[model samples]
Target: MSNAASAQTTKTPGPGTYRASCHCGALRIEADFDPSAGTTRCNCTICTKTGWWGTIVRPGAFRLVSGEEVLGGFSRTGAGYSHFCKTCGIRVYGHGDIPELGGEFYSINLNCLDGVDLTGVPVDYLDGLHDTWEQLAAAPHVDPVTAAKRLSQTS
Candidate 1:
């Protein structure tokens, strides 16, 4: 496991496996645990349209259980990759490397998570529209690396 994975093991939903998927289950990822805190909402053009709500996780802690062939994705230069279920058109997850974050990270969509009710999870709203990293970094509900990524976005 990676440092991020080791870090994840110490966090919430404590050391257990949790499952998530797209609308039709055509895409699935098994996470070590559910994020019960510091998740976020992005207001960028793409995120705004898809309503993609997520929490950051290390690559080792997120396992793609299935549906690799049925998944589609979109990405832009200097931006993280957004993946979805090709059949149902449900945006499932996203990931990318953040140099400031130390390495690769997965953005797991909370809406795709099964058996997890994240209603009360404290959410940090990010200003992705204008690339507001300074403001995002100041938000109490998210990690510094995520705030860094928001700053790195290309328009």
Candidate 2:
């Protein structure tokens, strides 16, 4: 193949790598994803309490850079484990395999990202509390997708 074509094919993709760390900087992780694609906010009990703004990425795309010893995990939903920094008690990300979401995935907490600004990024709310993971939740307290569909049908 031509030299120019070879270089073009070998060049790495640009501008999406992000560095994230816990509050005390004990744990760190790196991932590559478009910030403009927005994040997901689930209305599940644990998510509501912990304030997780998640960016879903495949397992291969997420990397744990350091602090393996200090990392702790909690499995509230049984679907995945929410990993946190034991020192700072901050949830940095989660790992799980859900068939509905297309197998193994990592949900990175956007709040832990080092320098990325999420000013205008859209937040997709999910009614995980009601197990309606298929459609977006209208609001935190609003009805689940099925309930909303029923309401629409009656109306």
- C-alpha TM-scores of all predictions: 0.73, 0.75
lDDT of each: 0.71, 0.76
Q: Which parts of model 2 have CA positions greater than 4 angstroms off?
A: 1-15, 134-155
List where candidate 1 sits over 4 angstroms from the true fold: 1-15, 134-155
Best by TM-score, which number?
2
Q: Per-residue lDDT for 1-155 in model 2, tens only?
A: 43223221112223477777788887889887865666688888888898788888888789999889999998977989999999999999999999988999998997777754455456678788898865574322222564678789999
Across 1-155, the per-residue lDDT of candidate 1 in tens digits comes to 33223222222343366677787776888776556546788778878888788888888888998899998988864658988999999988898998876679888887777655443456777787878743353243344564677679954
User: Candidate 2 has what TM-score?
Assistant: 0.75
Clashes of each: 0, 0
lDDT of 2 at 129: 87
In candidate 1, which residue pairs get closer than 3 Å at backbone N, Cα or C atoms, i.e. clash?
none
Best prediction by lDDT: 2
